[model samples]
Target: MLLKTFRWAFAVTALGLVAGVLYDGWTALGLVAILAVLEVSLSFDNAVINAGILKKLNAFWQRIFLTVGILIAVFGMRLLFPIVIVAVSARLSPSRAVHLALTDKDRYQELVTDAHPSIAAFGGMFLLMIFLDFVFEDRDVKWLSWLERPLARLGRVDMLSVCLALIILLVSSMTFAAHAHQHGGGHADKAQTVLVSGIAGLITYLVVSGLSDFFESRLADEESTKSDGAGRPAVALAGRAAFFTFLYLEVLDASFSFDGVIGAFAITNDIVLMALGLGIGAMYVRSLTVYLVRQGTLDDYVYLEHGAHYAIGALALILLVSIRYQINDIVTGLIGVTLISASFYSSVRRNRAARE
Candidate 1:
């Protein structure tokens, strides 16, 4: 299973290293290796969360995820998405954005960095809502019963996750605004940018999640209503579910990739190298997600999802705080790794006790 999952990752990593060396010698190779590691480290929790979602998908959708989905992750998000961001933000044509990225590396990076506040707000709020929803929703099993129970009770309130996210965004924006004012900077603009981006994120999450839920529920109803003699219709129902599931996974991947893309700049300004390294890492993450889902890791290691969500919550806060402060990406990644590792260990211990 490990070999099946990681075979492509190894091949891609080799290709990335070769490309790295050809591009700018051994130094570039080393940088690519470091960036790949960084991407993988930062995205482990993302893979865990993805597994929880991907397991619900059918075999066809899972295959699509491995094939078409990886293409989207590699070229679409890791490569083209950055260029698109630069184009839209700087109001440049796509060709112009590409030229700027290749010819004037620093300017390209500056444009990307300048747009970080909005990106952070959007990605951070989206992730925050994910974490909130996971924590607040009632479940048969609880990892942190004391905390989750209270949150679950609160979840009964309509749009609780949306409301809490807005409140947090408001607080974060106000805090940043005050700090900017004290420093004689663009206070109101900063606040407005954060608010608007966060609202956009919230609306996006609501809409995408709503659509997915609606289709999923409809599929469930159809499946339940089908007589035993009917078996399962392979095309219509499954295709619709697969389509929406694909969209959900793609959006989820985009949200997860935002921080990795931005953090890659801290390592290298070369867009090609960044894409190669991060793309390699993203492929590994997708593979890991598939492994977890196929192996029932989420079911076996019961608290794993809880840990992943908690890590996500931490990451969301870090992203938001990073709008005003420069936090180390390694530190953020390490926090998530630690939380999930601890949970895995706890799960092992619990299983051992259960067997005894």
Candidate 2:
């Protein structure tokens, strides 16, 4: 089982290498590997988030998430989305755009490079909405009721997420529509486009994050079970609702990965490199999710999940801010790292206190 499983990972890596060599040559392939590591490292929180959801899913859905989810991540988000953006922004026919991207690497790079602001803006906003909804909408009074109240009341992360999405929708579509009207008239109005795109990014964050939280909470309600047997190892079930819970988890993973995958193009656009580097990082995320689930980290740490979720909420806000601000991904990664680290320390301290 282990060998067979390991083979899948090996095959994906090997295939990515072959694709890179055939398409872009040795140097590009090297960059692909490097970028993938960077993406995975930066997105460890994604795995933790995913695992929290995966534990709620049924066995079949888990397989589907691994298989179909990987396909979407690699082909759809990583490969196609950038190409689509290039095609539209560069005013080339779709086929021509792709050819340009592949053969005329310099021109292609120039075309998409400037689109980063828009991408960052969109992702930032979307993530902010998600973070807000989860933290603010669902408030329980643990020992930290005093703190939780302030956090929950201040727009409730979930509500903020929804509002962000609506704001982005109004802003992006309006700009695009206006631009379409003015298409061949001037300096391409890239700045205005970037601004609109940034707003749209915030909107996307709101919608995706809000929906994810809504669905997750609904599933949690459906899965609510008091039986001890329900909370078993590998996957603890609050009830048969675990199936829906799992589904919600997968969707959540998809949402968190959106920015990571989209932002990756800034580093390099070779599909092969994107796949290999991001794929490896995703593998570790998968591993992390499974580790978290198997270790019962949530049950033990209690507030660790809370802290991570809160951190995710913060990240979403940061991403929203980046729509206009252009905050570096490294800074974003550091924010997440700090939150997770703090949560980890808290967990350890709690454990020690219990033992004492």
Candidate 3:
């Protein structure tokens, strides 16, 4: 089962490495390997979150995710997205951005780094909303009951998650972003950029998530009324609901990729190498998500979702902090892995107790 799931990931890794070596010899190959590992470690939580969502879609959408979705993730997010950022931020044309990336990698890296504040704010706020909604929602299976219970009760207040996210964005903008601008002496107003980007992020989350939930709920209601002869809602989501859900997943993947894309510069500034490495990692993440869904990992280990959300919350905060301060990727990766491991252990203990 494991081999069946990861066959493509392995194939990609082999091809990516061979391409890397042919492009720039052993040095490039090493950097590619490091960057691939970095992306996988940083995005393990993302795979978990994606599995939770991807399982709702039908096999057609799942195939779309593994095929067309991967093309978008690899080329769009890992490669073209950075170029787009540079072009927009630096007021250059698309072709010029590509030229700069290929010809002047150091300058390319600088422009990308200069754009980090807005990127972080946007990605941070989007992820923050995701984490907030998860924690605030009332779930029968609670991981941290003492804390989750209170939050769930407060969640009954309509739009509470949006309210809290906006407040946090405001405070972060006024405090961290403003302070960073004053100390760093950047020409742009970091605070203003952060406020604008954060709001954009918040609105994006609302639109994508709201539309997805609305369509999905309508589909559920429709499906609930008509079941198979065995008396079950059709096991797959389809139509507009599936489209929106797929859209939501892509946006979620983009938000998660922001930091990794920028952080890749620290290892290597070659655009082709970055794409090859990150693309391999992304393939693995998608494979892992499919494996979890097919294996029923989440159903068996209920708290795993909770832990991934908490890791997401931590990552959201880290992204916000990174706008003003530098954070080691290792630290970010360790925090996520730790939370997931703890939850897995707890799930095992619960299973053992139930058996007894």
Candidate 4:
């Protein structure tokens, strides 16, 4: 199973090595390898969460996710999305962003870095909500019973997650804005940017979740009608369900890519190289997602998803802190890997105890 799952990753690594050598000699190959490792390490939790969603999809949609979804992940998110960020943030044309990336790499990096506060706020808030919602839900299976039980009880309060998120945002923006102003910068402007960006993130989550629920409900009704009436009428309904599912997956992947894209700048400021390197890593992550679903890894290790959510919560907090301080990327990546690995170990111990 391991050999079969990593076949594509091996092929992509070979292709990436060749491309790196041709583009900028052997040095580029090393950078590509490093970036690939960084991406995979940071995104393992993302793969676990993706499996939870992908399992609900039909086989056809699953295949589409591996094939079509990969294209979007590689070219759309890894490549085009960064360019769009530079374009909009710097108030330049897309062509200008591309030219600046290839020619003025240092300046391009500065602009991207300048935009980080808003990007961090947006992605951080979105991910925090995902973690909070998962932890608060009442469930049959409990991973960290002491902590999760208390959270589940608190979940009964209406809009608890939203309220908590807003309070955090308020405190963070005000404190950071004040700090920035003490050095003679524009305090009010900084605070406004954070507030707007955070709210945009919150609204995005609400809209996407609402739309997905509506589409899923419609699909369920169609399935019931088809089962009762006996006909091929439900085929169109299946397509609609697939469409909404596709949208949800794309949005989720985009949120995951945000941190990776920004963090890549810390490694290499060259946009093309970042894309090539990170693209290879993304293909492997997608392959891992499919492998997990096929192997039923999530079913075998029930605490795995819980661990991923905890890692996400940790990451979200780090990003939020990064708005005012520089957090080491290595430290951020290690926290995620450690949490997930510990959970996997606990799961193994539990399975053994059950057998005994």
Best by lDDT: 3
- Predict model 2's lDDT versus the native: 0.61
lDDT of candidate 1 over 1-356, digit per residue (tens): 89988888889999999998998899988888888888899999999998988888888888888889999999998999989988987889999999999999999998888777778899899999999999889988887788889989998998888888999999988885335322223778778888999898888888888888888878877776664656553333366666876787888888888889999999999999998899889989999999998899999999998899999999999988888787899899999999999889888888999999
State the lDDT of candidate 2 residue by residue for 89-176, as single tens digits.
Answer: 7677889887986778667766665554455445555555555555665455232457667756775443464565566545543444
* lDDT (Cα) of model 3: 0.92
Expressed as tens digits, the lDDT of each residue in 54-152 for candidate 4 is: 887778888888888988998998888878888997789999999998999998888887777778788888888888889989888899999999999
Where in model 4 is the C-alpha error above 4 Å? 177-185, 221-238
Model 4 global lDDT (CA atoms, 0 to 1): 0.83
Error of 4 at 123 (Å): 0.6
Question: Which residue pairs of candidate 4 clash?
Answer: none
Worst 10 residues of 3 by lDDT: 179-188
TM-score leader: 3
lDDT per residue for candidate 3 within 1-356, as digits (tens), equals 99999999999999999999999999988999999999999999999999999999999999999899999999999999999999998889999999999999999998888888899999999999999999999999998999999999999999999999999998888877876643245534788889999999999999999999999988988887798666567658888999999999999999999878988988999999999999999999999999999999999998899999999999999999888888888999999999998988999999899999
> What TM value does model 4 have?
0.92
Give the worst 10-residue stretch by lDDT in candidate 1: 176-185
Each candidate structure's TM-score, on Cα atoms with residue i matched to residue i, is 0.94, 0.73, 0.97, 0.92
What is the TM-score of candidate 1?
0.94
Q: State the lDDT at 195 in candidate 2.
A: 58
